[model samples]
Structures are given as structure tokens and as C-alpha cells.
Target: MKLKIKNKGDLIRLRNIIAYKVFKNSTKINKFVGYRIPRRKCDNYLVKSLIDITQIDASLIVDEVNYYGKMTMENRFDLLGSGWVRYRCDIKDDFRGQYEYRGIPWNVDIKTGYRWAADYLDENDCIHSPEGVDIKNVWELGRMNYLVPFSLHVLSETDRELQMAALIHYRNVIEDFTKNNPVGIGVNWVLPMEASIRISNILISYDVLKQTDDKDILDTEFTILIGQLVYSHIKFIWNNLEKNIFGGKNGNHYYSDIVGLLVATGYLQNKNVFTKKVYNYAREEFFKETKEQFYSEGGHFEGSTGYFKLVAEMAVFGTAMLIRNGEVIPGFVMERLYNNKNLAVSLRKTNHSYYSFGDCDSGRFVKVVPHGRFLSNSEAESKYLNLDGYTKIYGKAEKYFLEDDSSMDSLIRYTDGLIANTKNDTPSLEAVMVYQLAGKRLNYQKKYTNGNMGAEQNDKKVQISLNLEQSVLEKYPIKKSTELIDFKTQNKLLDFTLFSKMGFCVIRSDKASLLFRFGTNERSGHGHNDTLHYEYEVDGISHQKDPGTFTYTGYPEKRNAYRSAKAHNVPYYGQEQREFQGIFGYRTADNREIVEFTKSAIAVRYRNMYFEHIRRIVIRDNKVLVEDYGKRDFDIHRKMQLRKSPAYGVIDRNIET
Candidate 1:
């Protein structure tokens, strides 16, 4: 059959090609797959409600129109108002709404296939559909369900008129859809219900939908619909929380806390429906979980910095919500919140940077809330409003916390008393070490992890210093003199000797000082790859250089590597994974000790009995000394190699000075 052409020669060729295929495939598919399934009646209550409200007939509405066949007809409309209009029909499915609201006219041209129908499949035949055809196959038909009502502006109308028209159209469409109960088939059809409610509220706030004689009908209906959606979302979260917490599901309690906070905020803002009983129940559950999960030291039990921040933010928000609502805040909840804040603050260095351990976002350090915010529930919002005052308060508080020498003394004495009074029933030297290390020291700077000792100086050196006598080593059984001391201005030279009880630390002005740790019968569960790890400064940067601790559950890599022992900086020549090879008993031999003389070099030694490894470092003059002692018969094939990078200087100690 000769195809009739209207607008241009290209239009005729394209329509003929598509029409030919549609005729052929529609026949073949019907023969092979039988007739297409009829559209099922949609059971969507909301859509039905909308349709009833709009009083629109669902069946009579032309959802879509196919233009391929219609374009072959003789009748034409000037969509562009050009006398040379090319299309055969003025209102063909393809051109019907193309030029409406200032949209580009859909014209037939040859390049590749049509963009819209590139991935189009016919539900009738389970095959590709012809390009530029009104989507007829049930599968292709479902794509229309995902169409969202958007604002349209006609070129001739003013901005206000267009906006008002758009608003009326939106209301009409929403009403029609609610009454029609349209069945959405695709994943994209899942409307952003929450976003829609918020938008409707905003529109109401703008007075675009004014109250008139029909105010009760318009405003009351919209309000009830929005309320239903908000309540449904809140109820879903509440049910999930109960299932995760009380039902013993493996959901994270921290996630539960965040959801609770969100719910509380929504309720307080009058956006969600929450009963008094429900709120009380949520609060009770949150308190119970926080007390059980959070550590007294303020560290998150999950050992994740990211998770810690998430939980802390939730707690802060919850606290503010409770205070605003005139509810009583629990003491332990406040205490834990404060403790978490302190831990986060302590993790920061003098350079105002933080360690990226346990999935921490380093960039978040700049946005840290001041200490005063955690002091009282009311102050949570103060940081955002009174930033200058908050900064001053934080500065003053940090100075007092770090500079109070009397407080440090009292803490040390109190820790010593605890150690002395405790029996050896479950002797844990690691606990004592942590407690002693907990006290803040003033005028003494050291790098923790992943930081250089003198970062700002551009020297990028590693140097460190420690007060050996005042440290936790006084409680250990080993004599201080047997320990080796090594010192270096940079990484090059070396000065070495045995150290005294008043342990010394090598401090390179532009580098991190190295303090050696050696002790018997102590284990920190949160110990690093270096059981005898050295914490110091490198080029003015501090890092949690110690390899992190690990557990056997779920993480088989950690368990296989013997909790990262194979990756320790120390030498472990002959020990099997998990095998203890030293003189430590009951307690795991993980110690942090540095031996220093009155004015000479500083020697440090750390040994992990479990890994059968030792790292000995001595610092004197402008030189550094290092010795790796591993088990003599350890299997090199199974053992990990010691990877050392000596950056600054040559390692030589025998040259006579």
C-alpha cells in the first residue's frame, strides 16, 4: 500500500517502516503467544478516592494515542502554525501534546531509532514494539503509570496565571488518580509519597489553594490524605523498631535510635500522628538500648566512628525533643551522650584534624559540636545559633580539661588505688594500662595514629616523648634498666643504650618521638597489630598507627591472620597464629613501656607473646636504632614478613663518635 506523506518525505518513510513492522509482529506474536491478557481491575483505594473526588470518567479518558497509523491519514492540524506543517494529522498521537505548554513538536526524522521507544517491548508478543507507535502492549502500556504531574507553562500566559493553572491541574490530576485506582506496575511508579505530602503542605502554606465556599471539601480532604500518609510511614518505622529490638532480629540498635528520633521530631512538629503511649514506649526502649549498648568510656560498642556519630546525633536530637516537650531526661542517657562527645573530641589532634579509624569521615572534624552542647540538653541547638560563643566556650573547656595538673594527679592516684586494691582473680594489665593512659597530659605532645610528629614544619619527621616514671609501667614487674633506648633527630642516625626507670622519649623537633613498650601479662582487647606497638608523632601528624583489633566472628580474615598479628610492625619469626610463646600467663603479654635515662637516649621494646614477635627501638642524638627479634624456628612460609620503610637517615650504630 502506498503510504500518504504530509509534512515531509522523511515523515512518510518513518511511518511506513513502523506500520509495516507493527502489522507483521502483531500478527506473529498473537499466533505464538495467543491473545494478550486483558487489563485487570485496579484495587488501589487511594486512586479510587481521587477519581471519586474529581468526578472524572476513567474509561473514557484517552490515556495514550498512537500516531503511526493516524499520521497516514489526510487531515492535518498546524501544530507550529506553519503553512508548511508536515504531519498528515493535526492531532496524531505523536504530535497531539508535543507543542502544548511550549514543548518541542515531535517531528519524524531519520537518525537512529526513537529515543522513547528504544527499550520498548510489547506485552502482547513479548517482543520489541514499533518506534513512534502509541504504546499498545500491556507491558509498554504500564510505562504511563509512572508519569508524575508536573507544572506546565503556556508561552502566552503570564507567570502567575501559569502557576495558578498548574496548581488547578495538579489538584485535578491528584483527585482523578485517587478515584481511578490506577495500578502501578514499574519500580519507578512507587511515588515519593513523603515528598508529595511536604510539597502539598508547602503549596497550602503559600495560599495557592485558598479556602472558599468549598474550603471544607478542599482543605479537609488534603489534610486528611496527608495525615494518613505520614502516619503510615511512622507506623512502619515503629513496627520495624519493635521487631528489631524485642523480636531479637539482627537489626542494629543504633538504627533504631535514629528512626525513633525522626519519629519524635515529626510528632513534635505536628507532621505525624503519635499517641502518648507510643511515645513513652519508644523513649523507654531507646533508654534501655543506649544503656546496654554504649560503653562507659564513651566508645561505641561497634567500634565504628561513623556509627558513633550517627548514634550521638540521634541522642542529641532525642534529648532536645524530650526537653522541648517537657519530658524528664534520664541521667544515664545524658551521661552516655556526654561521654560519646568527649571521646569524639579526644580523637582530634592539635591541628584540629581527626583520625579516620573505624570508618570515620575526616571532613566531619570541622563540623564538630562544641563541648557545651553536650553539657545540657538545651544547648544542642545553641551550637548552630551561637557559633561564636560556642567556640569560645569549647576553647576554655578544652584548656581546663587538658591543663588541670591537679585533676591528672587525682586520676592517676585513683587508678593506682584501683590497681593496688584489685586481686589477681582476673588480672588484666591491659585494663590498668587503658585506665592510666586515660588521664589527659598537658605540655606533652604525642602522635596517636596516622599523624606526623611535626606536620606544620614541612619537615615531615617522626619524634615523640613520654614521662616513663609517671606512666603505667610503674605497676609492671620488669626492671626498667634492661630496656633499650634509641633516638634520632630524623630517621638517619642512631644513639643506643639501656634505659633507667625514669624512661626517656626521643623528641625530634619536626618528627614523632618513639617510646618503646614492653611488659608481661597484659592484653587490651582493642589492641593493635602491634601488641607492643609504639604510638608517636610523625611530621607533626598523629595517627592511630597501631593495627586495629579483630574478632573471630564473621570476619574470617582477621581470625586467619591471627587478629592481624601477621601484619604487625614487630617481627614474629616462629610463632603460629594464636600461639602464645613468651613468659606471660593468665594475661596476654601486650605492654606499652618506654625506658629513659636522665639525659641520654630513649630505648623502647614491645613484644607480642601471642605472635612471638618483638620490636626494639632506641633513640639517642640524631640517630635511631631498631632491632626485629622473631622466633628462631618460625615458618617463614606461613609467617608474615616485616615491612619497614626507613625514610630519613642511614641505619648505622657501630661508627665511633
Candidate 2:
């Protein structure tokens, strides 16, 4: 591959690449023999407590785990548009499989074959889908999240035969992957972020498996394979840490690198001089980055809800592992994580879902798919009230409650319970592990009345309740357990709840909810040009939506369009809010100032170099009025950016982003 230096950022990144290559060649690192699974040390009381709390269906877990034995998975691909595709693999093969999109292989370039070394491929180039490739499809399988379901089954199942089958499948997968993909080669190793994610899932899977007390699964060979895989991932992440060395804000990729290193080093069995150095380096960076990356208000600096889920998971799990190892976590870390949970609770709708304001790839440290909910719940179409009537097609509405939200909910609930030593919802095996590691009491009682996955608040629920109440100030925070005696008809006033540092203002009542994205226009990584973008819902039905990101680099035009200001529910000018520098970054800036906000009305102003646009929204008698004002000559378009993206690589249609 030829090097193309377009700007200063590229040059600085190239320098780091060169430096990493030299270090890898010059240093002699110690070899990792194998790892001892930490689940073997789990408390029996904690395991049983989680089983009862989650109420996981044994038969469903068995069926899902068996599917992995067939090496088949059902998932959605954004490149091909809607619908889930079933991917079947052969463990005997070298893992060069591909999903055909429009009769063309998605991950494999017909000419190059995909065995290129990490140094050969330029990740930024999208050189035609047929000739090049989108590497995320391969990375998805490499994540190995399916192993988690199998591990959970092994823990919950009673039949010996079923447990054995799950164990066999798990061992076969490890053997196949480690045997085929060596220490460093192939598309799977193209990005260390993938390696980091894979490491975390692998570690969690095996930790749960070891807790099953099944010698058949925790044999010598299995331990060795797991050790080598983890060691390789750790070394790769250490050598290729995604640091923004040239002085810009580091995003989730770099955070994942630190998390991968920290988890691997902390849990690995064989620790030596080299491993100690790696652990220390990762530990130091983890704390510093956690403080810098997140605002005090507990929002990630990237201004994306999807990225917030990712970084939050990393911080929580990393903290849990440290605390388990007798390390005293700083108070600030706990406070920040608490605030993150509060933010998550604040953005949640009455139905327990969140709006996708900016870019969301469904990225998570662990992919928790409970009760076989592979696909999320969505509406076919939503309607909007216009000049004529409520006849305008608003857009496709989607609710993302399964994928990463489950993992976050479990972590937040357990973290609160762990700190306060109270009851919590142990929704996943990992959450149970976090609880068991801390020796927290399992006083959890299932309250199906809440209807929110049986989640209950602990004694330290003051912050969370306060945040939720702050969003809807007229009345107490609505709980599913509360009797809905004509809630929609109640005339309750909802004042605006603003997180000034994070640039999000929310107005919610019993029957209507509105969210606004207003902040400085400049965004670095995983940001969409959505200044003054807003989403409004009436009677729990979405009327306006933010066109979420469909793909990053698969198609450049689509990437630019989806993140542009025109792809949102806002007053768009002829020009974009910021200039797109590359696939992820931006140049130039704009300003969004909130002039006035109240219970009944709100006004916001957007300013760029060219002109200024002001928008005012008022709510009266269950009716909304949207008024836009701008320069006399500057034309404004109130275009409804209505593309629905529930997850990464998934969109409403193939024709659009």
C-alpha cells in the first residue's frame, strides 16, 4: 500500500505507525503460556442469586447456544438495507467467509483475498466495494459475543448433556480461531479496536464458563488456547495503542485500547516484568483518559448517545475488575459512572428507550442479547401534523432497548447495588460476576409491576431520581409500577432540563417529549453536523427524527449526507454547519445559543460564518407550533431528516444512508 499524506493529522498518525513498527521489531517480549479462568473463583451464592434475579429461560439459552455449534448467526447488514441475514461458517475453513451484497462479497476483495498483514492495508481507503472491502463484517464475528450466550447456558442449565454440547462448541470455536488466525495477520487484526473488543468478550465468556465447575470444558487444552488468544490481543493493543499524540481529543477507539489492555493484564494468569509494565501503563492511561474524555455532567465529549454507551461500559467493567482485585477505586470514578447512569436514565423515554441523536454504531464492550431478541422493536411509519392534518409521513421509528442498553442497564444497576450493598437486577452473567466479585448481598426481589426488566432502585437512588424528576418537573418521575389513571389527559407542565456542558436540553411531559441538540458546532470523532437538531414525540409516537449514521466509510457520499445538517429535524440553511474533513473529523465551526427555555416554549439560535437562523417551538393544548426566522434573502428549508438507523450497518432502506 502506498502512503498518502493529506494533512498534519495524517502525518502525525504515520509517525506513530512508524514508531510502533520499530518497537515491535526491536523489543523481545515474554511469551504467555496460558490463563487461568477467573470464574473458577466465583462465589456460589452470587451465581445462584443472579440466576434467580435474571430469571433466564433455560430452554431458550440452550437453543441459542446450539446455533453457535452450527457456526451460523442471524444479523442485519446496512450495506444491503433492511432484513437480517443468516451467516454460516465452517470451523474447518480458514475463516475467509463473506456475505454477498448485491451479488458482491462484502468483506472480501475479489482481487486481493484478505490475508494481508496489518501493515499492508490502509483502513481509510474505500477503493470500490468490489475491489476493496468493509472490514466491520469480519470484525463482527471476531467479537465472539455469541460465546457469551453459550457460557450463560452452561451456568444456568441443569442437564449434563446440554452443558457438554455448549462446552464442545465453545472449545471448537477457540481452537478454530487460534489455529487459523495466527498472532498477527488477516483482516481481523487490521484494527486494534477490534482486538480490544474481542479480548473483553473472550475473557468474559471464559470467566463464566469456568464458573460452571465442568472439568470437561476447563481442560488443559482449552485453557492454553484461551491464554494464547488473550495474550496476543493484549500485546497487539499495547503496541498499537490508539493515542491522539498530536494533541486532539481521544475518542472511544483509544478508550477501548486502554480497556482491553487493563482487563487482559488484570485477569491473565501469568504475570511477569513485561506484563507488569503493560499493566501499569494501561492503568495510568485508563484513569487519565476516563477523567478527560467525559464531562463532569457525565456525557462523553463526542456528543453521540451511541458512543456514550460504549465508553461507559468500558469504564464500568474496568472499574469492576480493579475493585475485584483489591484495588481501591477513586471516588471520582464512581461519581462519574453514577452520573453516566443518571444521564442514561434521563434520556430514556417512558417506554424505556433512548433517541439516537448523533452517530451510533451499536458499539459495546459486550453484546448482551437476552431472550433471543436479535432485532429491536420499530414502527413501520409515524405521522406528523402539517398545514392540512396529521398526514405527513414523519419517518420510520425504532426503539433500541436490546443491544447495548441491556449491558448498560445491568452494569448501572449492579454498580449501584454493589456500592450501596443493596438489591439490583442481574440481567446478564457479567453483571452477576460484577456483583459476586464485590461480595454484594443478593436481596433482589422481582417486581414485574415495574415492567422495566424487573429493575429496582437501591438506597442510593437519590441522584438518579433527581435527574429523572428534573427532566419532567411538573410531576414525579413516571414508573411502570405507578397506576396510569388517565395520565395522558393530565395537564402537567414539564420544564426544560439542560445539561449545559454536554449541550442537550430535554422537555418531557405525560403526553409529549422533545429533545434538542444544541452546542458548539465543532466535533472531532463520531459527531454528526446536527446543530439545533431536535426530535419530538406526541402520545409516545415519534413525529420528528434525527437521521442517524448508516455507515462510516462504506460510501463516502452517504456518510457525508447522513451526518449533514439537512439529515435532521431542524431549520437547515443552504450550507452545512461544519465542513467534513474526513470520514470521522470535521473542520470549521458554528454556534447554537439557547435564547429562552420554559415550560411552555423554547427558542434557539444557530449562527455560522454566513448568516444566522432562529427557531422557536411552543406547546399549547396538545398542539405544537414551529416558527423559523432567518435573513430575508437566505432561504431556509424545514426538511424532515427522517432516515432511521437503529444500529450500525443497518438503515431504513438501501437507497438511503
Candidate 3:
């Protein structure tokens, strides 16, 4: 027989095949059974005793509904008593409605979008629909089942009846569906059964005590029906695990991870019926996939800083829990956690904040949680006492702290020693003596506009010095400047002015001197673009020029231009880029001062004399001296000149400690 080719028919067949494959691949069946003490046996049992003392009916408590309308019920509550224990109760309503039997408000409705799988249902009826299937159709067929019922037998009588009606309505829906169909495939239909059977065994004797009550019959019926549902669900998960792990989907790593999480949660809760062998298999499968997700740097391969933190935290917690339970933790888990912790520590700044390297998620800068707190929920509570309060605390312990360091100690020691020198009456004019004696301060405001070019090359490679006290200072009221006159003329004083602003200082004398600058290049060229260029003091005369100018674009062609050679005081005589526009030179004599202007190589042959150069000279007890070893000739000439203005702002003597 030959099949006829038709468009819609072919599409429908393909769709069906895809749907079948998805269902076959995705099916997981597992039963989670809970244990608790019987109601009558717990008259003074911690959790049950509270219910009795509070006079609340345990049966009327309602089941919670998540935002998606799925029902959720907890078989036990954490009692605030000395020890924690679980107490079992039966559902009075067949559907295990929102309330316990005595009508107490047993459940809370969670309005947020995040919810567990069992939250959706109208009592025992499941609200979730099958893949490729209509929800309405599933509802019509009565395949969905109610979630586990919240037992309110512990709540007060007044609240029990109030909450009972809602519970009954929910139970009726489940009962109706079960009556019509014996088998179903929804989360609600499955989980409650396993929970019920396990809970029933604990309540065996209590059943006889409540036998006379109508509520007892409904509870028993609900319990039995739920047990069947749970059995079926567990069978599904088990069968699927067996099929898939052995030989099923070729690449479903996500599914495998989910299965591991589910198995772990069940094992921790003591809800799963899996034997030791089965449980071991599930755990091994989980760790295998988890190990591969780690990168060599110990970060999650997903490349998200936030995700890495989250995953690493979870992994650490899980491993700790397993260790506490006597399970062997994989070595890779410890390695990954240690690596990530070290990386995070390394990235922290002095302020305790991390540089936002890699794909960082916001809020990562929040205080770190204590290492002990990461072990378990109970341990965390005990150590911190209050989680909220602990999170607000800053800083870490000293031994493993990121802030305390040897590097900081060294910086502190250096700065403290230097600050001491700036304190006493004797000022070390070492920096000022080497660089410049007297020159108009180069105004950076004007020089920077043209270009910052060629500034790097002019930086002095040699050192020079001067005796500062011998120099003379004159105030130019009109120019708003202070000029110093140096008696010594040495090689026309190489233009260390521009380079000195970047921190280099030239200290030169007749014997020997040194040029000292900590960092380099404060300009576009070398990198350090400091405003204070050169410094030199002779006798009482001190000349310090601010940063020099360089063309912003290309090198200056006029080597002799004021902006080029004399401006920065660099000896670049070749046809190369000039540093700045103008050069300011000063000399002082007994009665007059000489100022020289070099417009270009052609502009100034002789120095200009300024007769109004009135200046005071202070002779300190220390004699002014110059030291030069004679790499180049040193010449001292007396030239009278009016002092030019100091380019930079007034010198502030205050030094920070």
C-alpha cells in the first residue's frame, strides 16, 4: 500500500511524532514519602502540642495556592520549641482544599510569579496541561489532580470551619476527577499520594481514635487515593531515569542536572522511596555534569560573574551538606570553590569593592557572607544569630583579610619619612637648586593650546644643581610675577624647565648635582604632564618655571622659536619639533638686571638690561655652592636684569603629613 502525499496530513503526522518523542524523552517519575508522628501520640509532642495548646483545629487548615493557582501543602511546620519534629494530620476534604478540617487558615497564597511545580490546582486537580495538548481539554477530560491538602487540625475551632469550605470545594474537584479517571499526569495528582501513604503509616493508631468522626473517613479516603497517585508518579520518574541514563537522549545535560537537584532535595527532606543504590546513581550522575561546567580559573564557564557566584555558592553548600551527611565530596568541588574565592579576593580594591572585571552582575559589591554561614541553613542561623544584622557587618577576619597588606605598610613608611623633611626650619632646596635659577614661569594655560608635542624628548637625562640662598628675588608688581637672579651662568642652563614640571628637578653646582624625579611623562608624549616644570635656587635667588608648552599636533620646525627651544629650555637645535613658543631668561647684577629674549635663533644676540631690578638678598648661615664634574663647560657671568613674573600660583609652604 502506498500513502498519498498531502500537505496538512504530513504536517500533522510530523507534529505527532515530535510530541511523542518529547514526552518519551522528558518523562520522570519519582515518589517522595514523608514521615511524621501520629496525632494522638503527639499530645505533648512539640509541633502537635502547640496545636493542642493553641486550641486550633489541625484538619481545617487550607492548602496554599501559588500565583499560578497551583496548590501547595506542607505536612509539617518548624516548631519554635527546643527540638524540631514533624506531626502528621489527615485531610477532611477529599480534594484537600485550601483549609484544614477544622476550618483554620492553614495556607497562604503566594502572589509572586516564582512557584514550585505542585502549586497549581483546585484541590487534588492538577492545573498543568500536557505538552502539545490543550489545557481546557485536559480539564474536560479530568486528567489533572489536586495538590497535597494542607492539614489545619492544629488550628483553633473558629478558624477551622471558616477555612473548611474552601478545602471542601477543592476536594470535590479532585474526587470528581478521580471517580471519572483512575490515571492522570499532573504534578498535583502525583506528589500528594506519596506524601499521604508515608504520612498514613505514622497516623495508624490516630486513625482509630478519629474513627467515630465523619471527617476521619474523608481524611482516610483522601490519604489512600493520594498514596496511589504518588506511587504512579514515582514509577514514572524511575522508569524514565532508567531508560534515559542507560541510552536515551544524546544531549540533555540540563535534564540530568535538574534530576540531580530534585533527587538531592528529596533525599534531604527524607521524602524519596529510592533505595541506596538508586540514590547513589542519581548523585553520581549529578556531580559528573557539574564538574564539567567549571573553568580553569575556577569560574563558571557561563562567563557571568553573578552566575558564577551563585553557582559556586550553591555547589559549596551542596558539598558541605553531603559531607555532613557522610557522603564523599568530589575534589573538584573544593578546588573550584577555593579558586573562585582567591580570585574574588584578588580583585578587591582597598575600599573593599571589586573592579567590575568580566561579566559582573550588579550588587556584587555587597558585603561577603561568612564562610561558616555557607555550610548549612541551621548553622548559619546559629552563628549569625540574625541573618539581616550579619549582612550589614563590614570587613573580614585578619588572617584571611584582603585589606591588610605589606604593600600598604611600605607606602605609609615612605610618605611619613618624606613628610618629616618638609617640617623643620631648614628647607631642603635640593630640587629647586638643580633645575632652574630665574625665569618667567611658563603658563600652562597658554602653552597647552598649540600642542603638547616634543615635550617627551626634552626631558633632561642628566642632573645639575645650584646654591639657592645666593640667588636674588625681585617682585614685578606690574607683571604680577616674582623673579629670581642667579649669578652663575652654566651652559645657558639646558631647558629642564618643561621636563621639570613633570616632576624632574635639576640641582646643579660648581662641583656636582643630581636631577631627581619620581615619575615620568606628564605630557601627551612621555605621560607625566606636571604643571611645575623646573626649579633652581642660588644664594637667596630661586627660579621655578611651571610646565612648558609643546605643539598639540606636529613637531615645531623653528628650533630657535621661543615656543620651540627657549620656551622649554631643551637643546634640540636640529630641524625637529619645537616644544613651545617663547623663552624667558634672567640675570642680576649689583644695580641692574638683564633679561634676554630669543624670538628664534635670529631674534636675540645680546641680553636686554632692566635697570629697575630692585631685589633683596638673604644670606643664610649655609653658604650657597654649585657642584659640576665637567661633562660640559660651566661658565658664570654677571648680567643685570629685572626679574620676570612667576608663572605658577604663589608657592604654598604647607606640606601634608
Per-model TM values vs. the true structure: 0.35, 0.72, 0.25
The sequence of per-residue lDDT tens digits that candidate 2 reaches over residues 1-657 is 566764433453455346445554312111211111233432210111112324334443434344332332222222122222333332233222332211212244222344334433355542334322445555666666656655665666678875665566566556556544444434555577888888777777777666564556567656655665665677667666777832576778898888888777767555667677887887778788889887655678777887887788788777766665566666566656766766666676655556666777656676443322333223222210111111122222332112322224543554553455333444444455555544442222222122211022221111224354334332322211111222242456564555655667677776666677776443546778777766766666665567677666566677788888777755555777778887666777678766655556666667777667666555565445555566543433444444566565545532231
Instruction: Indicate which candidate wins on lDDT.
Output: 2
The Cα error of candidate 2 at residue 546, in Å, is 1.4
Worst 10 residues of 1 by lDDT: 399-408
Model 3: residue 386 alpha-carbon error in angstroms:
37
lDDT of 1 by residue, 1-657 (tens): 233333232242343235434644332332222111212311110111100112212221211111211211211211100111222213323212322222111222111212332212222222232432222112111212112111101111235544344444334334332222211111111222222222222222212223211323244455444343333333333432323332342123433433343343333333213444556666666667667656443544443344455455445444444544556656666556544543444334334333322222110100111111122212322322212232343333321100110011111222221223222233232222222222221121211222221111223222345654335343333221222232236545422211111112223333344433232222222223333434444555543243322222212343334334454433444443234322111233344444333233333444445433334454444444453444343322213432211110011122111
Off by more than 4 A, model 3: 1-234, 241-274, 296-299, 302-325, 337-657
Candidate 1 local accuracy as lDDT? 0.30
lDDT of 3 at 338: 44
TM-score of 3: 0.25
Q: lDDT rank, highest first?
A: 2, 1, 3
RMSD (CA, angstroms), candidate 2: 10.8
Give one digit per residue, the lDDT tens place, for model 3 in 1-657.
122333332333233334433543212111111112233422222111101122222332322212001221222221111011122224343344344422111121111112223222232122222222212222211212112212222122244453345345334544543332222223222322222222221222122113222454336556544444333333333333322321332112232333433323332224333434445664565476457555333444432233345344334333433443456555565445444443333333333322221112111100111110012323322332112222223212211111111111111111122222212222221111111111111111111121111122223222212222112121223211122234343433322111222222233344222222222211121111111112343443333322222111111231123122133222112321212322211122111111211110000011112122211111122222221111123221111111211111111122111
